[model samples]
Target: MKTLDFKPKLVSAIRNYNKQTFMADLMAGLIVGIVALPLAIAFGIASGVSPEKGIITAIVAGFAISALGGSKVQIGGPTGAFIVIVAGIINQYGIQGLTIATLMAGVFLIGFGLLRLGTIIKYIPYPIIVGFTSGIAVTIFTTQVKDLLGMQMDAVPSDFIEKWIAYFQNLTHIDPWSAGVGLVSVAIIASAPKFSKRIPGSLIAIIVMTVVVLLLKQYAGVTSIETIGDRFNISSQLPDAVVPELSWETIKGLVAPALTIAILGAIESLLSATVADGVIGDHHNSNTELIGQGVANIVSPIFGGIPATGAIARTMTNINNGGRTPIAGIVHAVVLLLIFLFLMPLAQYIPMACLAGVLVVVSYGMSGWRSFTALMHNPKSDITVLLLTFFLTIIFDLTVAIEVGIVCACLLFMKRMSETTDVKAVYDEIDLNEDADMERGNLEHLSIPKGVEVYEINGPYFFGAGNKFEDLMGGFGDRPKVRIIRMRKVPFIDSTGLHNLENMCLMSQKEGITVVLSGVNEKVEAVLRRNNFHKLLGQENICNHIDLALARANEIVG
Candidate 1:
């Protein structure tokens, strides 16, 4: 709660009114709006919706997120993370269902913020994050291949293998012009950084390719590919509001997709905020950001927009071009809105293949190839998680991939921790050496006398490692004269571990052998006192160290 406070001084320092900062913000906003143009349309089309909704989302949700969000430079809009979820909702429940689901997700996000669970969400494991992220990248790439190559399929299949099979069936009808354009677009976007740092490669590719496509359409009479106008009617007017049906039945149907959308949106938005923090050396209020996103989502859908969140690429573009405050993001939204009203007609000529080309570049950029390669050199368990998540996301679905990946990672981590826990026995053998400093007669060695045994336990004694205690103590065939348990290195113990220890003491007493404890740390001592282990084992037998326990053990044995 304390971490969520917004410092007025920090805000004033950044929000200082100046012509230089305002001009810089305006230019950055314009540039990011251009970068977002193709992506907005492509993401909408890819989600099986018309192009205008994506633009509206960028205008409405993007504006609200920046104006009211926690991060200063986060550029918000429709993101790839929401692609799988929105598509799934549209397929199962239709456009109306998708809207309702987005609204529900927004409400959930608002609740999440109010509960102040923002910081805790960071505890999600790194392997799980990478696994799902890489998986989504692969899926986005796979989904765009058909459009990029201009494959002549009536409807693209959603299943992974089936999608490829459909693509192969249409391989013979591939449009050379479209593929050439996509390849060119990829090349230009890929090489943008080498030549110019201010302008984005995707924006350049879109301009060049749109010109080329328009020329071919005018002179060649070769209409082999589709454009945004071909699929959906182009309209500059805001979509008419229609309330979606949301009875219990509709709510029940959309619950799963709604939850998935909420989770993905939360993760992507917060991660982008963190990245912006690293770039500008400032902190963000994650809970407040989430609440802002929720409000934007709730309102955007009513205006016929899709699920939206902070986009990493757009946010980075904002920072690189001198955007340093939330004002720049608001300016970006306004710029996009102005374009929608006055320039939407011109967008009709933007070919779907060109948009596809833009998405192909997006897919490539999202791949995180270096990070993927680095994970290959990680531990086997992590590698397994990476592969499992990647394959599951491609072959099955994103939701299942995340759920199973998290579970598998947790179980594997516990197994590794358990393996590091052990018990060992030690004997003082140095005194037997001839080079001992003490005289042979005077030199003394501690030994495990007959009918008495000792053991040392090390590491955390959680439920997983606690079972080993039974195995070690069970080795005694029957009650011995005395037994000592050492736990100097045991820093922590839980209820289950204490339960096992209590049972061990009871069994030893039942077998007529007194059990002694040695070398307990303050943490373990607290548990011992709370669980009454000292009372059960006897205070006299609970010695401070091994030597004391050994002496007491010898007396009992004698």
Candidate 2:
């Protein structure tokens, strides 16, 4: 069994802590915290929770992820990706359901880490990931249209098509003042990057738009514009812990969504860690990263927050701003906590349309349109999976898209594996120099007996290829007296492959045909010994070369 990787990067980073590193971390943390503020608020509101809850998540979950994560500069908080699922859960099962689901997801993440399945997760089909992420961006963009345009509607339907139709119906009811504020907010955020890299665009958009909205509402008598204060009762202090009532029924109902959260969290956190690793020239412990994320998710929701994961954008910001340790992340959490305790009430002045505008940019970033378009030029099968996952996420739900996408990817993988492994019969040739075994090189050619046949397997003998090989074996009619099976190129044999080989041995025995194994690799031979195939086929008949196998076959033939 593998040892648990529970060590956090903070522990390792602190061993070499210095004043210079501390100052650098402080600066980066301060900047990242400022960057996280508007995003947290926007992600919070978009996720169907209050703005304060988003801040609370940034403080609490952000701290946990940084303090306990394996990566040096990973920043954890509420992100735009969770908006769809969190909102959907709230819409269906209520707040308690979201809470329980987050808790369950945390448990699942911990289990995944403890099981040491991190490397496996990193290999999940890339196309499926792109598809899901792109679809999420589209869904997020769709959700923001109402807020972005200031549509006068009671409630936006959750279904994708229904929501768009309602938007069309409400097009004539657009609040011009709100629309003006939203459009201006979007323009500012979209263009602010050219002004200064030191400041975040979303923050500038909020400050500028908040002042404009306030001035218009106060002096110009424009009462149509909406702000955070008008929507949610913004809180200044950390809220009391919320204990959700859990029942078996609730657990059963939330399992699917909870699993989705676990998968998303694992994929995102590890991807962020991997990206940070490339830039930092350091490797992150994936298991430790996952456990840290699990801890964050489990704790944040108790404080009335939603699911939390490592934010890639903020992480890159930390790197770009000279953050080289977990200290920066911890400091960022402290910064957010201070804001939560003191400056949270000011968030009420932040316009909801500005947040919608912030998210509008966010959605566009996550769209991965360049990658999506590039993938369109890939293999037809990849394109099929991409489009399927994309449409399913928009039309139905993320849960459905992920599950179906994974299944299809697996099936396609197996199909490709089976196509690559081939079993060929070489009955006429006997070239000793052409032998695969290097140990038996530079020898004379050996002739095959009249009643002997030699077959070579070219790839992995997994279940997919095993069944086809078994069928080919069954197709044989003029059975030879001596049959040589070459597996020098065979890397490993799964259970099905072993079973098929065992059955072939039994059938050959009953048909009075002597079977000789030649060039079986050490690993496959070890597997055969463990399964007692050596005992059934007789050990002498298994040879390291055709020279010995043919000699044994000649004895059997005599």
For this target, which candidate reaches the highest TM-score against the unseen true structure?
Answer: 2
Report the lDDT of model 2 for residue 21.
99
- Model 1 TM-score is 0.88
| Estimated TM-score for each candidate | 0.88, 0.96
Off by over 4 Å in 2: 438-444, 470-477
In candidate 2, position 318 carries an lDDT of: 98
Model 2 TM-score on a 0 to 1 scale: 0.96
Off by over 4 Å in 1: 1-19, 240-243, 428-452, 474-479, 528-558
Q: lDDT per residue, candidate 1, 85-171, as tens digits? A: 677678877899899999999998888887777787776777777878877877888888887888777888879899888888889
Candidate 2 scores a C-alpha RMSD against the true structure in Å of: 1.8
Residue pairs in candidate 1 whose N, alpha carbon or C atoms collide under 3 angstroms: none
